[model samples]
Target: MSFDSRSVVLSWTPPPRDNNAPITHFSIQILEGEHSDWSRYQSISTQNSDLKYKVPNLKPFTVYSYRVVAINRMGASEPSEPSYLMMTARELPSGKVRISEAYSGKPDSIFVSWDPITQEKIHGEFLGYRVFWKAREEDGELSRQADIKNPNQTKISLSNLRPYTAYVISIQVLNPLGAGPSNTVLVTTKQGVPSTPANLSVTSVSQTDISLSWYKPEHSNGKIIGYRIYYNHGRDAEIYTVNTSSDYNIYNISHLMPFTRYEITVAAITASLEGQRSQPLQIMTDVAGPG
Candidate 1:
């Protein structure tokens, strides 16, 4: 039997030695290479149905072997000879596409652009490009699709997106031959100041130092580069810390007055902006330790 360039179809007849028992089904086993395991590929339930089976999704640059086993009331029969071979498609896709996203100034839109593979590498007749995206949020996932009918089309602007939300995206090129593998990317819509950090607390305190911890914002629109720390008897009177990735959850504050109480808060930071401060946490340092 024949399958696609990267796959093969297999068929076989039942064993002659039935021992007066009727055949029940057949099982196909596959091995990608000599060192690979013989795993059951597929099973057929009908005794005399289409004994043929199509096995697809084979890698182009690898070798494979397959065998078949017949079963009846007694047991399974001896495995058949291994049919081993290599497969290749008419033209595999070129892995030279680039994808990027940028803020489009629209609060609910982003500009997505991509460069097609070089013409020199496109072995098959180009058909078009298909772009797929899914947004993941607290409630659930939402999916959207877009495409360019012309193979030469390069850029597309996606609108009506959620601000400060992330979208998983990928693109694949299609040809008369088949659809090639996809290039995937993650894009976070433009973000604004994040919500306040959560669960701020005082982990430890001492005569001259205080330790503080806090959870990240419930929704961090983009990658959190670091955090800013503020502490003073008053509201962030002092920029206690800045540009610190020091474990967003914990921070040790040294150089505090003995037997003194102070107020502190934290803010998450991204590439270009600092988020709102978390609720204040108070720390009362113990009296001076025995010097």
Candidate 2:
């Protein structure tokens, strides 16, 4: 556990009471420092059953040990062995910050801004700041990688980001002792273009009309607003757009020439970008409608 300039915070697990009486309270005793004596606080343990306390107003750099005991209707149990440790009080930072501004800095970069970690919240020494970020859907805090590692900067430009993607970001303080906890922010990069739709096929065909459907693209990193259907008969090209506010993966085209051959392709669209078109599917219309 880290320490503030004036006090040391001790945290520990309460001894198991399984199949035994539930713990009613605990007593903490101090055996070091200028105030070395049995603890003067009792109900202070009501904060939680996981035993923890902050012994304050002591001089720094002195060794210390804490003794703890559990009490129930049967009376107080014998104390557990004392934990001995000490640290010269050090400074750390705490904050609840957010990305004040985020924009696409370049084709493959995003610039992020944050509120400064105030000097007062810095408990001990003023060292530096760190900016940690990851893809929005990534898992495990220690798995892939972390922060921007800026000494005193409040803003950073993150490069090499995938277009139209979301990222989770955070900021923390660092001193000689260690780094402190940080709050997480969610941000999204600007949209580029969506990946091409795949598996274009004619689900059904009939005289003077044809029905078709397609699968969504592999990298539709943005929202799919609609689809564009392209059809060509010999020389002329025709386009039809399907504005989908709801789920739609199929369409029907009428007024096509009976027994005529046509080529068709499909493309997915987002609010600001159009994805690559699918491979063309050539098909001949039925000589007669299904009767």
Candidate 3:
């Protein structure tokens, strides 16, 4: 007729007087508070064995009361279980931990870092972690693994990774009861020859503009999408964009201040991330005077 614990299960049987006859249906109702009106009424066929139902998606840390009634084909029967106290689902009794950052430090490895969960109000005991990760291809495919146990250690290094690959990481907590869900995080590894632009040359200089080009590395594993060209005559830096047709050759950059030395550098941009800068290229424009 009633649950002994705070579980959100409702159970009932026929009233004492109606035990001999076949019960037609059962009705269950929920009241909001001690004096509030009933809010929900659910009916179940009598043929259902065990006569138990689970209430879902209820508010946490709240009180509720339930009552049940049995019915017959002729008319509705009297209430069986008058009322009993029950509680809804409570929030997870664990601390809040977060994976702060993940990145590639070198060519073939990645580092993962996280922050500790410091909540002091959790009643449940401390437990280990469940780590989940997926490797993504350049063509947009995702592969996932079931929850895997992680040691209490805060940082982990993943090695033997391929160049120009993207991976997603996630973490969750586990207790005696079960493991919670995971929160998603993403990271990408460095690709080909550590893109660095250097040794820029000015092909032509003019009063208001200049033409420039740079040498590309002989070999690289990563594809260079474009370049970020930076130039500064004074305190502020000006920017220009150069598109890469193919990594086989040099880039021509134009525009400048006449009779001034311009400092320039180039950065390699990939599909997922930007590469390191090349050596700085410095050039001085030709002087302009009365013709």
Candidate 4:
């Protein structure tokens, strides 16, 4: 018998005693796996006279054995001895690697772990694993990859990631032939402090109030929940603070001394942390007029 990854060919000699009647046909029976019962597979006619038959469409990496029975006009003969066990050649893995755990370890890194492929699904010798990742908002072509040479290593930590951004991660098993289908997961980095507020300017001012306007920070690492405005009349004067929601980019600070020069700075705030303040801008309120 000869076999490959998906088929087997068998050759046999005809029985010496054909009884009184000529041989009608031959029946081929097959057994699969270790404990499977025998079942009829195919039948061959004597007219062909060819002693060899090739069975096709067999599964890869499976165990199989075959037996033959001869039939004549008189009766059917006992089954012949079973052929030696045939094992198909191994192929690529049939199952996907599963991501069991994935989460942000820090503002700039993520931790990931996966479940190993089962032995039965690993059709060939396991070479290793490949991990692929990229920013969720970026294109697939920009993804980065990492190779794990050891099959037992199923966990990895990815660093140098953008804070407060989402990422897509994929894991696949590798064999001599190629990599198997990959499983993917999505994770987001932890919230981080925002960058400094930008473009602090004094839009309009009055004797007792100052109106300020500014642009958002270039890198708002997380959602901007609010902002803090710090202002003081002079270096030694007590600094006062005013808070405003993210919904507004302009704010008016009231109850300031008339004609006083004040140094002011602005900083952005996230739900978890506050960022650096912008460069201070100095402005003088309009002088008081006759009431």
Candidate 5:
């Protein structure tokens, strides 16, 4: 049997006298709020001798009693001792919403930011905070370990995540004794689209074809890099593609029909990533000069 300010848990072994008799069941009784009768609060099969239960949202400084009984083919054993106890929960002060900004976005990692709790809540007591997160794949909330006592720093990063997925997050305040409720938020990672290319312009135009050049956008965070170029003679014409590493800035199309009107576009690609297409730039193939 065990007692705390919040709950009572009791367990016991079945009597050896039931060696030949088949075991039957177990039961738990709660006597609370001026009740003298042993009401059947919960019950279990004989295979289960141990019973654990909790009563939540109880008033502070209130006492409660709990008892358990074991039943088998032979009969029920005498009820265990009635454990009476008072509960004491930690105190927390209320305040406005405070939080830290989430850190840089990554395919597999993210950082969270937050401010420290008000000192008034600390009053001779040590306090901490909790961060809760849930990946898109999971159905329930995942919580981080208690942060450093009276944490002043504002940022925490969660790493080792799966790519191309969504995540929801929340934060909570806690003290030496217990934790406060959580604050919730949502975030999604970069999935299908790539970054826009920079410095795009027509590099060359001729009777038969046109060449284009563009600079790859700078990715300070080190993502995979590549580029995709798209071209067509007109809005109704078929589009063709050319893929190249980020180092390649120039593309030439030599097979266009002479003197034909053409439209061209460019898009940047990352390592295993494809981004939005750049604005389409149109150019008319020069009329075959003296052809």
Candidate 6:
């Protein structure tokens, strides 16, 4: 007997006497696995005197055995001895990897976990797993891949990624033959502090108040929640702070001492953290006028 991943071929000698009548046909019986009973599978006509038959559509990585019975004018004869157990060759996996969890645990990285493929789905020897990821806005050709050689590992961390950005991740089971179908998930990195506020300058000035305006930070890692205005009368004087919503980029600092020099700086804030402050801007309030 000979077999492959899906089919088996068997060759047997004819009965010694054909039961005194010419053999008309042969009935083929097959048994699968250990618990299955033998059953009729197919019949072959003896017109060509062929002694070999090929059974098709057998499952891969399975155990099977076969038997043959001779039939003539009188009737069907007794069955022959069963053939030895035969096993089919291994094939590629037929199932897909399933992702269980995917989320951003840090500002610059994402964590992913998945359930391992069952042994029955992995038709061949288990080799490892392959992970593929890329920015959500990037093309598929720009994706990066990592191969984990250990079969026991089911989770991985993808680091060195841009903060507050979306990414697409995929996982697949691997074997010597090839890789199985992959499962995909989308995740976004956690929010990070914004960059320094840009173009800090004095927009207007008066005897007791100063108005300032500035551009948004070049890199706002997340939605800009607000801005912090930091000011002090002099190098040693007490520092005071004021906050403005993201709706306004200009702020007016009132109730200040006239004819006094003030040092000022600005910083952007997100929901999670504050960013670096901008360079200090020095400005003098207008002198007090005669009442």
How much RMSD separates candidate 1 from the native structure? 17.1
lDDT of 1 at 267: 86
List lDDT for all candidates, in order.
0.70, 0.70, 0.60, 0.81, 0.59, 0.82
Q: Order the numbered candidates by TM-score, best leading.
A: 6, 4, 2, 1, 5, 3
Candidate 1: pairs in clash:
none
The backbone clash count of each candidate, in order, is 0, 2, 2, 0, 9, 0
- How many backbone clashes can be found in candidate 5? 9
Worst 10 residues of 4 by lDDT: 40-49
Per-residue alpha-carbon lDDT of model 2 for 196-287, expressed as tens digits?
A: 77667777888888898777777776788889889989998899999873444778999988888899988888897788888788989989
Which parts of model 1 have CA positions greater than 4 angstroms off?
A: 1-103, 106-108, 111-133, 136-140, 144-188, 234-236, 242-248, 289-291
Instruction: Name the candidate that leads on TM-score.
Output: 6
Q: What lDDT score is found at residue 5 in candidate 4?
A: 74
Looking at model 4, residue 243 earns an lDDT score of: 55
lDDT of 1: 0.70
TM-scores vs. true structure, each candidate: 0.42, 0.60, 0.35, 0.76, 0.38, 0.78
Indicate the TM-score of model 1. Answer: 0.42
Residue 203 CA displacement from its true place in model 4, Å: 1.6
lDDT of 3 by residue, 242-287 (tens): 6783544454445555688778777666665565766676777777
| Candidate 5 per-residue C-alpha lDDT over 1-291 given as tens digits, one digit per residue, 9 for 90 to 100 | 444445545555555565676556676655544454656344433344444444443333334555667677678777777766433343553432266576437776777777776644432254566666667667764644436454665677777655555677777676555665566667665443555667778878887768888776543122435565666655555544555555547777777777776666666655656666777786777777672
Q: Residue-wise lDDT of candidate 6 within 39-85, one digit each (tens)?
A: 53444444434688787877777777778888888988788898888
| TM-score, cand. 2 vs. native | 0.60
- lDDT for model 2 comes to 0.70
